[model samples]
Target: MTASTSTVARTATPRGSILKQRVRWGLDHALPRTVMSYAARKGDLPGRLIVESGNVETADLVDLFDAARADGPLHRGRFSFTTASQVTVKEILTSPDFRTGIVRAGGPLAGLREWADIDILGPLSAPSLLVTEPPDHTRYRKLVTRVFTVRAVEQLRGRTEQIANDLLDKLDPSSPVDLVENYCARLPLTVITEILGVEASDQERVLTFGTAAAPSLDLGLSWHTFVGVEAALQDFDAWLTDHMDHLRAHPGDNLMSKLVAATEDGVGLNDAELKATAGLVLAAGFETTVNLLGNAIALFDKHPDQLARLRAEPGLWSNAVDEVLRIDPPVLLTGRMAVRDTTVAGMRVPEGAIVSTLLAGANRDPEVFTDPNAFDVARPNAAEHMSFSAGRHYCLGASLARMEGEVGLRVLYDRFPGLALQPGAERRPTRILRGYDKLPARLS
Candidate 1:
């Protein structure tokens, strides 16, 4: 077998491992709702959350977040400290002392490195912009920013619209379809691949690997998932290493080629750093956009009147995109560690304390957003949501993701004026990423 095929073959998850994941998924649902409800009202939330681990639905999560926010901007708990207030989350995210890496020296989760066996994962464990401190993050991000400049992303608009229209054309309007698979999943996967210069045939494998690797970002991962995630990362690193070499010899007008040539302060990234950076962009860009598109469609289905408003005013697509992002952020929560002792929103956070920023909760802060739970497409200032996060780590793909979402939603509704959700829409069984696994829809 060829090298790429061998990599794919070795990394495939076993049937038994898949079965284990399914059983664990069932247990997540079987956990009592009353326990979580009662805890939100009367008990120790963070302590109880050590068990639930933010596994509850989005609506249910708001209640817990509200309760947490009521206490203070920063609440120290048994399992983790959390910042539910927008002001506090922004402060922590922007603080020069805090870093994203879990294994940082003297950080709260530093010990987890050995326990999690992160070292064995090779490039998977390499610190990319997502999980590195300044100097390194600043340097790496500067190179990436040059490639994703505003003009560059804007140039992608015509092609993105074309891709959206072409995907829509493939759908049979008269029949029901799983919008997640047939529409939402395809768009970002194709877009990121085309941007990364992956061959058409290899794009499918990239997508498959990305699906497994995405979960590596989760706070809690099962052993089965761990094996699958590491294997996928290994495969991706091998492919990326080869691709970087090829890009060096024969430059193409693509992001990878630009990255290959990018230099800063008379320095450029080596092969390992290149793979990690590319992997970070691909994995983060793919699933987050997938969820973002899925959330917009699913929310529109539930709020028909708002959908009608959007249909009447296609210009409000940007507002609709922001509203959906506020209501159902693809990335639910992120964590940061103090480089030293710090104060957040008047709360004392000592050195090594890990502060979990509840992004979705911050988006729904009543102080910031009036009627925070309601989905109003026409709501003014919807762009104020903290879903894309803030400070230096703000999503690099935020603009690209937004454009794709706007175009994807607009094209779908324009094609099927009466698009409506079928009865059996299913949310993915993930706590960190909130999105539908299968949004059955009728496009009549």
Candidate 2:
């Protein structure tokens, strides 16, 4: 199907029933215990279920991150009203419905227009290639195949390592440091910016804009946060347009240049599409990796023995990263709109229903993983973790993210043999991305 046809079809689809189901499910599965019980007694389904239940709010990215940090895999009240709307879709993604791809047919975003503000031009509209069935997914995957090839990512390993080391060099062990601000945040930002051929001065600006842009998918124009987001999008569009123009005139050896050179059946990414793709790559490539690194460090600190094991057997770094991601994926939920009626985990979901898979929950499902709560670097099936997700929509930067984690950890341990968490470092009050806002440690 052509993009124009898909766009027209998506807009024309009726979503009243799907919206009702979403509201119903939000109330049923997302409400606080007392509130839900009260509603149950009153027989008011909608009344019983709160739109932003404090218990299952994973709605806000920050709250979701905090909840994951405080409570391992599945935690109730992870999202407060303030945060739920943002992460509601992600919460659903972690649920069992996602694994079956039934939700993908008619995912949540389709029905969420009433609840959230989503940009139709974004990946949300890109047929659930990540979660959809094989043939279509395979075809879509092929289109972008060159972008995420293992060799494509591996080519940047040397540069990634250099970026990691450079960030580490800036660490001042004397004073309390927010690892997220300094290293965790900086490493991926630098790497991704480099990949996009963004200049050093523009790295932080681009990242700030990218981060703001991500939450805009749900926060919309009403949320104060989105004010910055809108501005960021405008800024990013301008920046990318200029950058792509430059690359068009003066091609170089970079991802942006390659993308500019790439063509599909003699059709290439137009200016707007190029900007969107660049924005997506910048946001995902940086923000998620920052969270992943921070979470990994926090987990290592929490499990000294596991850290010790890794220190002894550096090879375990790969499995260790996987285990950490399984326990606390950087991205908690991914959204999809159901294209048709589907049943998941015995729940009869109607067509156009918003399907959310809680990836963290799915990763921790006892049926799928043994001792799901434990942080075992040696778990034989650690690589089987769905932190990067499975199927078509899998993260394109999985390899690069892993390389950064492995190299970062290896360097961290080697440098600070006696690194220990500071006496008190408060975590940031967000849930969607798990990591310490300030991780102060003494690096001896």
Ten-residue stretch with the least lDDT total in model 1: 1-10
User: Every model's Cα RMSD, please?
Assistant: 6.5, 8.6
Model 2 weakest 10-residue run by lDDT: 1-10
Which digits, one per residue and each the tens of the lDDT, describe model 1 over residues 175-205?
A: 9999999889999888888888777788778
Candidate maximizing TM-score: 1
Question: How much lDDT does candidate 1 score?
Answer: 0.74
TM-score between model 1 and native? 0.86
Candidate 2 yields a Cα-based lDDT of 0.57
What is the number of backbone collisions in each predicted candidate, taken in the order shown? 0, 41
Q: Which pairs clash in model 1? A: none
